[model samples]
Target: MPVFPKISLRPEVENYLKEGFVNNEVVSASGKAAAERKFEALLNHLSHPPSFTTVRVNTHLASVQHVKELLLDELQQVWQFNGLSVPVLQHPDLQDVLLIPVIGPRKNIKRQQCEAVVGAQCGSAVLRGAHVYTPGIVSASSFMKAGDVISVYSDIKGKCKKGAREFDGTKIFLGNGISTLSRKEIFSGLPRLRGIGIRMTEPIYLSPSFDNVLPSYLFLQNLPSAVVTHVLNPQPGEKILDLCAAPGGKTTHIAALMHDQGEVIALDKIANKVEKIKQNALLLGLNSIKAFCFDGTKALKLDEIEDTEGTPPFSPESFDRILLDAPCSGMGQRPNMACTWTLKEVTSYQPLQRKLFPVAVQLLKPGGTLVYSTCTVTLEENEEQVAWALSTFPCLQLQPQEPQIGGEGMMGAGLSGEQLRQLQRFDPSTTPLRDTDLETLRDARAEDMIRLANKDCIGFFIAKFLKWKSTSEKDPQK
Candidate 1:
C-alpha cells in the first residue's frame, strides 16, 4: 500500500509523464516491468516530503560546527516529541551542510470534527514543516473558533471554494492543528490576513520551523542545490554569472564559495524576484553578489565588446563561470500532491531552456565553466537538453561533477554511458521507501541516515559543461 496518494495529474499529463519514463531506452535497460515500477515509485515519492531537512551553513559567516551547535541547541529547544530528541547530523562530503530528520506521516492520528482546508501549495509546506498561514486556508468550519483543535486537510484537487463552510470535494488529511484564526477572520472581505492561521499541534511530518532561526548563518537548501556551487567551483577574484537567479539561493552560494572576494552577477527577469535576490544577499551579509533585473536570453552584448562591470548587456565571453538555473515545469517538488498544468504547459519549458543555454555559453569565457540546472524530471528538460547542447554547440564539452552523490543521468536521452556518468540526476524514485519514525531514525547509523537524506530530496537535474575553445582560437559557430 502507498503511504500517500500518488501525485494527482490530469489524465493527459500523467500519460505524457508515463511515456517519458517507460520509453524504449529505459525499458530496454531495465526491462518493461522494472521501468513501470520505477515510474510508479517516482509518483509515490512525489507526494511525500523528503525524510530530512537540509540546511547549508554560511561558511563565510560561521563555521559549520559553530552553526551546527547553534542549530542543535535551537532544535533541542523546539524538539517536542514526548521529549525524545532528534540528532542533527553534518554531511561527510558537503562540509557546510547540516541535516535534521523529518519524523512522520503519523497515520495513527484520528480526524477531528472541525476541519480546515488549505491550498495545495500550503499543504505541501505543512508536510515539509510549516504552520498554516491564513492566506492558504481556502475553507473552514462555519462555527469553528480560535484555539479549537481541527483536522487540517489539503484541497489536493483544487476544487474547494474560498470561504466555504465546508469542502466536500477531494481532499487529503494533513494531520491536526489548533486554529488561530476563526472562519470570519479568514474570510473577512477587508484583506487577507498574513501569519500563522493554524499552529500545527500534531503535524503528520514534524520538521523544525526555520523562520528566524540563525537566518544569517543557515540557508534552507536541498542537498543537490548545495552541490551545484561545488560543481561550479567559483574562485576568488573571478567573475561568475547566475542567470535566472531569483531569491538567489545558488547566487549567494557562489559568492560564499569565493569567500566573498569575487563578483557574482545574478539576473532574474522579474523586478520583485530581483529585489528578493538582493534582500537574501543583504540578509546573508554577502557583499559580492550584484543582482540585476534583465532577461538572460538577451544578456549578451556583442555590439560593443567591453566589460560593463556587473550590469546587463555584458560582452560575450566575459564571465569566468555561468550558472543557468533554467526555469521548468517544476514536476520534481516534493510533497506536491497535484500539478494542474496542461500538456502544453508541461512541454513548454524545453524551448525556453534552449534559449537560455546559448546565452550562458556565450557569456562564459573560453575555458570557463557553465552549469545548467533545473528542478524538473522530464528527459526533455534534463538529459535531452544535454544531448541538444552537445550537438548545438561544438565548443562545449560535458564535464565531470566534483561531488558525485546523485545517480547518473537517465538513459532515454541518447547520452553515452560516459556522458551519462558526467551528469547528476537526483531521482527520488531510486531510493527504497522506509519508515521515518523517530525510533527508526534514532536507531539508524549516521552514514545511512545521511545517505537517505541525500537521495530522498527534491527531483533535480544538473549538467556541467566547459567552454573549451577560446575565442581567438576558433570561430566555429560565428
Candidate 2:
C-alpha cells in the first residue's frame, strides 16, 4: 500500500521532470495518459526503498555457492535471535548477486506520543535499514529518557534548526523506535554521543541491517551498480582503468571479476576518497588494485617520452578497458523525500561528464571496451551522451550486454530502436506498483519478492561501447 504521497519537489523541479516524461517522443510512443502515469509513478517510487536488499559476493576469495551458504547460516542465526524467519535468495541471472526480501508498510503499528526528529539524509538511511545514530538526531522530547518509546519524523523541508528543542515546520513521520540515550545524554554536556541513538523497533519498511555481517564475503550494493562491472567483462590478465572511482565499490568488483590477477588503476581527485578505495580493496584481499589521488581528465600526457613505470600520464591507448562511472546529479537515489536544489544545480553535471568522456576514450586501447554509467534518469545525461559519443568518435560502436535485465534505453534523444536495444536502463517508475494491502505484504511468496526485486531497483543507465581502429586513417572524411 502507498503510505505516503508522491515525493515533494519544488514547483520548478516538478515541472522540469514532468516535461521530460511528457515530451513529444514519449507521448507519441505511449499515449499522453500513459506517460503522465509513469511520471507520477516515478515520484512515488523515489520515496520508497527497493523491495529487496542486494549483496555482491566477493567471488575472488570463495565461490558463489560457498558465500551463499555462509550468508544463509549467518542470517539464520540473526533471524533466530530476533524470533523470526525470512528467505535469502540468489538471483537467477546475476551469478554473484544475492537478494533479501524487504517487508514493509507494516499495518497496525502503534504510534507513540513522544517524537524524535531527524534530518533528510538520516531518514533516507533509516528507510534503507539503518538505526538512528546520535549525529542524525535533530530533536527529541525534552523530558524523554532512555528506554522510552518514541515516534520518528523526517524534517522534509530542511527547515529544522539543529539542536532545537522543537520544530513546527513540515515534517513526516517515519516510524517508531526506542530511545537508546536520554535526552540529556544526547544534548547535554556529554563530550560526544556517537553510537546508535534510537533502535528502530518498528519501521515503516522492514529490512535487515548489514552492519558487521559477513564483512569479508559480501558487499551491500545496488543491483544496477553490480551490473556495470559485469557488463565491462574484465579478463584475468588485462589492465583496466576506473575514472572517478571513490569508495571503490565498482573498482573492487572489477578486481574480483578478474580473480585479482590483473592491474586495476583506480583514480579520484579527492585524497580521502582515494584512501577509501584502497581500504575496500585491502578488506576484500584484492592486491591487484592500485589507487592514486589524481584528476582523471588530466591523466593524459602529450610528451613523446615513455615512462617505464605504469602510472598516470601514459601514452594513448594504455588501458585494455575503461570504466567511466562519472559523477552525476543523483536524482535516482531512493527514499528521497525532498530535494532543495535549483534547476541550474540539477543540470550542471552533463558538462563535467562530457569533459571526462574524452579522457576515457583516449586512455582505452583500440579494440577495447568502455562503459559509461550514471545514477540519474534524465535524457540529457543518459541517451544524449550516447548520441554525442557515437557522432564524435567514428571508431566507437555500441555493444549489447550479456544479461540484459533492465528495460531498453529511454526515447526523446533521437536514438534508433536498435541503438536503444543495446542499452540497459533500470527505471523503477515504468514498473507498475502493486495495489495490494498490508495482508498481501504479510503473505508474499519468495518468487513474488524476487520478481519485485529485479524491477523495483534505483533509476540507473548503462551504455557499453567498443573502440576499433579508426577508419579515418584510410579515408579523411570517413
Candidate 3:
C-alpha cells in the first residue's frame, strides 16, 4: 500500500499537525482510530503525486473542447514511443478543466551507477512531469558524461552540497534519466540554465510535460486553485483586487472571467513576482490587470487624497470584490516528500493573514465579495482564521460556494455545521490516493473520475464572505 515515504517533518511540527487533526470535533465526528488513520494517510499522500494532472483551459483564447483536443494530440505524439496513451477527460463540474491521470510510483526500474541529485523543489516538479532544469541540479557524479544514464535522486533532507562529488545523506530515488549536461557544464553554466539537465527516460511517475504544449490555450493549475476564482465569481466590469497575487494565476483567471473589460488590481510584496503577474497577463492577452509591487496589508489609504490614480493606498471600499489567497505554511502541496521548516516557521502565517484580512475588508465595496484561500491544511490558517474573521468583522458573513467539491471545514474551530459547509477544505488526508492507471481510469464513469480528481489534488482551503455592511458603516478597526 505504501508507495513513497511519509512526508518528513520536525517532531514538534508533526505533533502540532497531529493535535489539530485528532482534536475533539474531528474525533467526535470520525472517532479516534479513523482520525489517526487519516493523519497517517495524509503524511503518506503528501510524498506521492496526485492521481490526476489538472489544467485550466484559457477560455479567452479557445474553447475547453479545442484545448482538450490539442492537448490529446500533443500527449499522444510525445508518448507514442512508450505506447503511453492516456485519455484526457473534462471535469463534469468544471467545464474548463481537463484531467490526465498520473501513472506511477513505478518500482521496477533498475538504478544506474552514475547518479545525479536535484533539489527538493525540482524533484517535486519531476514527480509532476517536468524535466530537470540545469539550475536545480545540486550534485552529479564527477565522471558523469552528458549522454550517460544516471540514477536521479531528490535530496529530500536538503543536505546535499551544491557541487559535491558525491552525497551520502538521505535521498529518495526518483527513477533514472539521461544527463544532458556534464558536471563541468552544470557548474560552469551559472546565472542561467542553458537547457534541461536531465531528460527523464523512466520517471517514477508518468505525466505529460507542458513545456511548449499550448501555453496560451491552457494554464497548468491545481484543480482547487482554479475553483478559488470561480467561487470569487468575478463579474464583468466589476472592480476586483487580488490581495496577494503573484505569478498571477488567479488574477489572470479573474480578468478572463470578466471578459478583460474590468480592472483587476493585483499586488505582491516582491518586484519579480509582480513582473511575473504582468507577464502572465500579457501572455494570456488580458489587459484589465494592473500588478503592483506593494504590501497588501498597507494597501488602504488613510490619507485624504481621494485621487490616488490606479496605485496602492487607495480609498476605503474601492474594490467591488477581493481575493486574499494568503501565504501559508504550504503544507498541503503534494509530493512534498519533506518539510525542513521549524515549528516557528510553520506557524508564522496566521498573523500575516490577519493583518491582510482587515485591509481586504476595508478595500471592498458594500455588498461586495471577499474570497480567502490558502494552499494549506492547518486549522490556524483555515478554519481558525474564518472564526476570527467572523468575530472581528461583523460585516463579513460566510457565503456558500458553487461546485462545493472539497470537504467541510475541520472541527475544533467552534464554527457551526452550516458555517463549516460554506468553507471548502481540500484535505488530502480524507481522500485516499486512487489507482492511477490511464487504461483502467478510462473505463471508469466520468462522474466518478471527476470526483476523484477534485479530491486527489493539491491540499487547499477556500472561504468566501459577503460584506453585508452599508457604505456609511464605520470602520471597525478605527
Model 1 agreement with the true structure over 1-478: per-residue lDDT tens digits = 3577899999999999999999999899889999999999999999999988999998889898899989878877773444758888999988888898988877798899999999999999998888898999999998999999999999998999998989889898988999987788877754556778998888888888887889999999988889998888899999999999998999999999999998999998999999999999999999999999999889988668576765788887889999988999999989889999999999999999988998888888989999988999998899999999999988999999998889999998899999999999999998876667877876899989888888999999999999998644655697
- lDDT by residue (116-191, candidate 2, tens digit) is 8999999988888888988888888787789999899899778887777787888877889989999888776464
Predictions in order: lDDT: 0.89, 0.85, 0.89
Worst 10 residues of 1 by lDDT: 75-84
Q: Is candidate 1 or candidate 3 better by TM-score?
A: 1
TM-scores of the models, in the order given: 0.97, 0.94, 0.96
- Scored by TM-score, the top model is 1
Give the least accurate 10-residue stretch of model 2, judged by summed lDDT. Answer: 78-87
Rank list by lDDT:
1, 3, 2
- Candidate 2 ranges beyond 4 A from true positions: 79-81, 188-192, 306-308, 435-447, 470-478
Per-prediction backbone clash count: 0, 0, 0
In the predicted model 2, the residue pairs found to clash are none
